[model samples]
Target: MSGLTVRHPHPSDHAALQGALTDWWGGMGGEAGAQQRRLLVPRLFLQHFAGTSLLVEEPEPAGTRGGAALRAFLIGFLSQTDPDTAYIHFVGVHPEAQRGGLGSALYQRFFDLVREHGRSRVRSITSPVNRNSIAYHTRMGFRIEAGDRTEDGVEVHTDYDGPGLDRVSFVREL
Candidate 1:
């Protein structure tokens, strides 16, 4: 993490982040990954909530002609309706950079940002099918919120996004 730089995302980052999501998430393959890609970071988040979002990258190789290489990102915002709460909409870590504490650093940075703004808690959601995400969040000290229903023994919010689009919810206190 020494060489990596953390900065607020700009509108220019949307396309590149989208590409990273596609590449990092490509393991799902076929329609599943495609569907997730559509729900990944949208332009409006970077445009409106850049202050609270973060982009992590390492400098391009010395001989390279491009910008830094994307390593990870977290898109989050303090809730307008619940001033004491912040919501993390999406997060991604380059596959090659996994297990190096990059994801934890992003979350820690976001927690500090929100806490500075008076937020006492943070919330996020993930598909129950993403067992890795669920496990990761749990390991990060997030408590899974009890939902209306359970699937595969995991609590989930039925129709959280819409009919049949269930999600597992997580909340962590700052």
Candidate 2:
């Protein structure tokens, strides 16, 4: 149990983040669905870090402990929807690190970052069947904003697509 540091992501972290996502989603199902999940990362990374994505890291004991491991991440960007809105493109806590309060810490940092930019709202979406994600969001104080929605198979539906992947949208005012 070390302090968690939340900061903006660097381009070099992309591969590691992708690997984490693969592992995270694959644990939920298999490579096929994981492949679908991978598609979201690039888009969100580009959109958010076009100059803004947040990363969470926890230090491990120096010796063969693998140094710092990325524990959670939030990829999103400041939006013009209200100038005061931060649209969360995607958020994930490494499977091994779930329930450790890292997710909440990551989001709190995100909200603080948003507020620094003068944002007043934060928005996100989660799969309808992902009860864990829904529970996490609810616990973080998000409220359902839209009913469930699905994307026609041909489109690449991501979080920013407003609950498009058989999910529902949730929002919280900052």
Candidate 3:
């Protein structure tokens, strides 16, 4: 989108990024709102996975943005538990920048980096209620894992996150 450039996220970017997600409650239920999720995200993710995570920006005065700015970001990493797979921890695009391909670009960038590192697959999980995330992951070539079932219109993986917080897990071959 708009010739965006990509790079690792700096520590200072966390607050702004978190703030940007303040209203991004789509798909997530009230129990897992943006604000609630923010508390669970440690700052270390930005510091430790800087190389694998990425920040996407639009050049100054480009597109609808008035100046060079962060358009989207991806917080992902090679899985520590599974060496052959990478995990996309988080990904967000400013509402204004969405639908402009910025999110796709960030995903493509992650796929390339992980593939270079010998990763043969990628995985991610989202709340069952977050339909937007499920669709987006599917669009990125991730498929729902087995055992997931639709309940009351929500495709769920029972107890995926905890006893009650069912989640949708996605997997994609790299």
Strongest candidate by lDDT: 1
Predicted structure 1, TM vs. truth: 0.95
Provide the TM-score for each candidate, comma-separated.
0.95, 0.80, 0.84
Q: TM-score order of candidates, best first?
A: 1, 3, 2
- Show model 3 residue runs off by greater than 4 Å: 24-32, 59-68, 152-155
Better of 2 and 3 by TM-score: 3
Tens digit of lDDT per residue, candidate 3, span 1-174? 558778888788888677656655454545457667786556888889999999887777645657557678889988888889999988888788788888888899899999999999999998776778888999889998865688666567898767887888889998
**What local lDDT score does residue 1 receive in model 3, on the 0 to 100 scale?**
58
Best by TM-score: 1
Report lDDT (CA) for all predictions. 0.90, 0.74, 0.81
Worst 10 residues of 3 by lDDT: 23-32
Q: Which pairs in model 3 have colliding backbones?
A: 27-129, 27-130
Clashing pairs in 2: 49-52
User: Stretches of candidate 2 above 4 Å error?
Assistant: 43-51, 60-67, 148-164
Ranking by lDDT: 1, 3, 2
**Could you list the CA RMSD of all candidates, in the order they appear?**
1.3, 5.0, 3.3
List, residue by residue over 88-109, the lDDT tens digit for candidate 1. 9999899889999999999999
